[model samples]
Target: MESWELGEWYGEFLDALNRHDLEAVRSLIDPGVRRAHLPRGGEAWIADLGEFFHAFPDWRWKRIQLVIEDDRIAAHLRGSGTHSGHYRDIAPTRRHVNVAEFAIYRVTNGRIAEFSGSSDAELRAQLA
Candidate 1:
């Protein structure tokens, strides 16, 4: 896809994600999308989000920037939400938090094929 088209595609996916629409999110991903750096499939990706969204009921992802290079899309984003549910072994703080993140996503055939991301150092300290 062209850079502009790919950006639009990601925008739509993010919109669906913000709305917490699982079906819409699924529509934008490949059936075999990789999770983390593992070989797991799209369901794993979806399940991971399920956990994240559960922890942050009002989770919001705002795209700060998007750069399309070849088949990869790099994104700079900010996320904020109230930690009101279980996250891993950490009990809910019920406290609002914000974090910045950067991610590189590979798209194949108009669907996300692979993704890797990192959050700001402050996120770790804040969560701790």
Candidate 2:
């Protein structure tokens, strides 16, 4: 896909995330998508994303920027939500939190096939 198309695809993906539409998110990701950062080390990227949203029902993902080059897209996301549910091994605290994340996605056929992300751990700690 062209760079513009990749940007659009990522935009929609972020929109779906902001809306907390699981189905839309599922539809946009490839079944074989891999997540490089997970408590369990590595797992399906979608599964990790689901875990995040499940833990924070009100989670909002805002795309600060999107850069597409070759077949990879880098997304800078700023998000905030309340910790009302369990996240991975993080127990429920019902605390409000804000996090900034940077993610790099490898796209193929207009779908996200692989991803790596990191967030501000200090922010999470502060909120918790």
Candidate 3:
């Protein structure tokens, strides 16, 4: 896909994520989308993302930078939210967090096929 087209696709996906719109995600992601380098696939990944909204009702994803090559898109992003519920066994601290990550996404025919990313370490340290 062209850079502009890829950017547009990636942008819509990000917009859906930031909106916590699972229906849009379901439409944009392949039924067998991979997660975090895992073989885990299928539509089940939808709820996996919902965990974030469960923990941070106001969660948002912001794009910092993006580079597109063919069907792959790499994005540098910022994620922020307030801890209003338990997250990964951590009790709610009501703390607001801003974290950074570099994510690489693979898209095929406009649907996301795979995604892998890592976020700032300090964000976890702050939780501890």
Query: Per-prediction RMSD in angstroms?
Result: 1.7, 2.7, 1.6
Model 1 scores a C-alpha lDDT of 0.85
Cα lDDT of model 2 by residue, 1-128, tens digit: 88998888888988888988777888887777776754321235556677888888898988888888989999888889988877766788888887788999898876777888895575568555
Which residue runs does candidate 3 get wrong by more than 4 Å? 119-121
- Spell out the clash pairs found in candidate 2: none
The parts of candidate 1 lying over 4 Å away from their true place are 119-124
Which lDDT tens digits does candidate 3 get at residues 67-93?
999889999998999989888778899
Where in model 2 is the C-alpha error above 4 Å? 37-43
Q: What order do candidates take by TM-score, descending?
A: 3, 1, 2
Question: Is candidate 1 or 2 superior in TM-score?
Answer: 1
* Candidate 2, position 93, lDDT: 89
The sequence of per-residue lDDT tens digits that candidate 1 reaches over residues 1-128 is: 98889999889988998998878888888888875755477788788788888998999999999999878999999989988998777789888889988988999998898888884356546768
